[model samples]
Target: MGKFNRQLVNEIKKEKEQESAQLKLREKYEVPEDVMIVEKDNMIKFSVRIIATLIKITIGIIIFLLTVVGIVSLVFPETRNELIFQLSNTLMQLKKFLNI
Candidate 1:
């Protein structure tokens, strides 16, 4: 039994040594290279797209605010009445110009 255990330990040690050698060979074959230019271009494009998206969102927000302001102004009684009066006057002028 002691001899059998010794043999088993020796076999395990041999297998471990073989695995370590293979790992060293693999590490020797693999080399690292620079990817800085690719990374920089990708970062710049990503930043540009982010800025463009932000600009579009800002424009959309501004247009939305203007629309809300226009609606609110039209909702007031005095402004509504004035707008209607102007529209009627314009329509009347158009009718006169067309001789209708």
Candidate 2:
């Protein structure tokens, strides 16, 4: 597996070198400054997509947890009562701290 990984890395490096050489050869045909802008745009777009996906996943997890809590509250009366008591106590503490 290590040998295969090394071979893959070497192949990728060689490909990148060849691509760079070609880009250099074609530098006169296009603006070099625009290349950087285009790369930055692609990076920003990719980053936004990743962030959106992460946000969606986080929301899904939160919803799943809420559903679990809801089911637990429905199934266990004692646990639901305990949780409500603890939540009220926490809220009261917060309210007192805020002098509200």
Predicted structure with the largest lDDT when compared to the true one:
2
lDDT of 2 by residue, 1-100 (tens): 3456888899999989877765775684575543532233588889999999999999999999999998998689998898899989999999999999
Candidate 2 local lDDT, residue 61: 100
Each prediction's whole-model lDDT (CA): 0.78, 0.82
List TM-score per model, in order: 0.38, 0.51
Residue lDDT tens for model 1, 14-75: 98986666666556665333211111358888999999999999999999998996797699
The local lDDT score (0 to 100) that residue 91 gets in candidate 2 is 100
Q: Report RMSD for candidate 2.
A: 10.9
Model 2 C-alpha lDDT versus the unseen true structure:
0.82
Top of the candidates by TM-score? 2
